[model samples]
Target: MAFLVDITSHLNHLNAQLQGRDQTVSDLFAHMNAFQRKLVLFKEGFSFSHPNLAHFPACEEMRRDVPECNKTFHKYRADIETLQEQFKNRFQDFYAMQPQIALFTDPLSATVSEQPPELQLELCELQSDPFFQAKGNERGILFWRLLPESRFPLLRDFALSMASMFGSTYICESNFSTMKHIKSKERNRLTDETLFHLMQIGCTNIDIDIQSIVHLQERPQVSH
Candidate 1:
C-alpha cells in the first residue's frame, strides 16, 4: 500500500508538471527523462513480493518465457525509448530554430558556453543577474517572466509556444467528473444550456455576479 501510494504521488507530480500553463516542450522532455530513468530502475528490480527473488525453478522459467516477465520489461523499455524519440522528432523544428532555448529553460545553469555567440552574450548577463539566480522553488517558465523580451527574444517565443501547448487533458477529465456528479439519473432532464452554464461557473476561479445571471424569462429568445 505504501509503495502504491508513493508511486501514485510521483505520477501525480509528473502530471502536475506537464499540465502547467508555463510548461515548455523541453520541460516536458526533462521531466519525462527523469521519470523514465526511475521507471527503468523499477522495471528492472520491482516485484510483487520480496525485495529480491531467490533462485526458484518457476522464476527462472518465467524469465525465459517470451510472453512473461522478461517480455514485459523489454516492452516497457522499448516504449519509453520510442515515445522519447517521437517527441524529439515532433519538436525538431523548434529545436533547430532555437538551440539556446534549452539553456534558458534551466534555472540552475550558470553559463551558456555551448550557445551561439549572439545568445551567449545575452544569457551570460542573465546568468549572473541576481533575479534569475533566485529561482528556488519556482516551476515552469514563471521565473522567466521577469526577463525582458529584447534580451531573450528566442527564449520568449519558445516559452510562449510552450505555454500555448496543451500538456494534458486534466481540465477535460475534471469536467467529466463534475458532469458525472451533476448529471445523475435524477437530473437527467437538465438542459444542455443550463449544464454548460453550471459547468462554466464551477470550473472558474472568478466570482460570478448574481445580478449578471439572466433569469429564464429575461433570456434572449432563440427562434429556429
Candidate 2:
C-alpha cells in the first residue's frame, strides 16, 4: 500500500504538470522528458540491496517500521521499468520529432547546415540578425510570429504549425464537459441549432455587449 501511494503520488504530480491552457508542444515534451528521467532515478532507487527511498517518502516511512522492506524493492523496480517502457512506447512520435521540435523551439541555435536546403539560408540570416537574436529569449510562438514573413517565410510557417498543435486533450475534454452540462436531463429537449448557439456562448471567452444588444431591440410606442 505504501508503494502504491508513493507511485500514485508521483503519477498525479506528473499529470498536474501536464495540464492547463496555452501550453505548447515543446513545453509538454519538456515535462514528459523530465518525468522519464525521474522514472530512471526511481528505478535506480528501488535496487534490492541498498534501497534509496529519497523520492518515495511513504515507502521510506514504511521501511522504518518494517526492517525487511527492502525485499519488496525488486517488485517496485519491475513496476517502474514497466511504466518507463509504456512512456517510451506512448510518446515514440514525440521522440521522432525531437529534431524538428528543437529547431522550432530554438531556431537561433539550430544547425543551419543540417536543416533543409531551402531553409538553410533563412536560418543563417535569422541566426546572424541582431534583432531576432535579442528577441530569442521570448516564447517560441511569439518569437516565430515576430519573424518577417517576407524574409523567413518557411521557418516562420514551420514554427507556427508546430505552435498550433494541441499539446494535450485538456481543451477537448473541457469542451466535452461543457457540452454534457448543456445537454443534461433538464435541457434534453434542446435542438441541435439551439445547442450549437448555446455552446458558442458557453465556450467563448468574448464578452457579450448586453447594453448594445438591448438597444438594438425595437421598443414599443407609448400612447399619451
Candidate 3:
C-alpha cells in the first residue's frame, strides 16, 4: 500500500508541476507526435532527405525507450498483483489464528475488546506463526525471530518485502577484505583479543588506533 501510495503521490506532483509550466511541455509533446509519424513513414521505405536521418537522435532515443517503458510497466503491474494475492492469504490466516492465540495467551481475557483491534490480529498471527514455530532446521536464519517485524504476517513475507530492491554487496565483502589487510604476515603475531579489536576498527568508517584501545592504560595522555 505504501509503495502504491508513494508512486501515486509523486505522479500527482509531476502533473501539477507540468500544469503551471505554460505550454512549453505541451508543444514538445505535439512535436514528438509529429516526429513519430515521420519515423513510421520512414520505416515504410519512403524516401527522405539526408537531413532527416542526421537529426534522428531524439527519434532514435524515443524508439529505444518506448519498448523499455512497456517492459517496466508490465513488471510493475505484475508485482502489484502478486502482493495483493499474498496479502489476501495472510489477511485470512490472521483472523483464523485469533482464537488459538487468545486461548494460548489467555482464555477469559481473550476477547477482541481487551486489546487494540489491529494489535490483537497481529499478535495472533505471530504467536501461531508458521515461520516462528521453532523448527529452525526446517527453516533458517530468517525464521529465527518474529518480534523484529510483528506487524508482518510470515517470515517468508517479510523476507520477500525487499526482494525487488537491489543493492551492492560491496560493504559486506569490504569487511572481509579489510580484516585480511589488518592481519598481514608482518602483523600476524597477535592475541585473539588484539586481532578482534584491530579487525573491528579497520572495518568501520571511524579511523582509530586499535593498539590504543587494547593498550589504553599504557598510552600517554595530554593534560586537560
Sequence-dependent TM-score of model 2: 0.82
Q: Poorest 10 consecutive residues of model 1 by lDDT?
A: 48-57
Candidate 3 residue-wise lDDT, 21-79, digit = tens: 12232222333335334334433321322122223344334435564432232233344
Instruction: Give the Cα error of residue 46 in candidate 1, in Å.
Output: 7.6
Candidate 3 local accuracy as lDDT? 0.43
What stretches of model 2 exceed 4 Å from their correct place? 180-201, 204-210, 213-224
lDDT, model 1: 0.59
The whole-model lDDT of each prediction reads 0.59, 0.86, 0.43
**lDDT (C-alpha) at residue 207 in model 1:** 86
Best-to-worst ranking by lDDT: 2, 1, 3
| lDDT tens per residue, model 1, 31-138 | 766766665555454343332223233433455563345434333335445545665676566556444445546744735677656556666676677776776445
Q: Specify the highest-lDDT model's number.
A: 2
- Comparison by lDDT, 1 against 2, better one: 2
Residue ranges of candidate 1 with Cα displaced over 4 Å: 1-27, 46-104, 108-111, 116-118, 135-137, 169-224
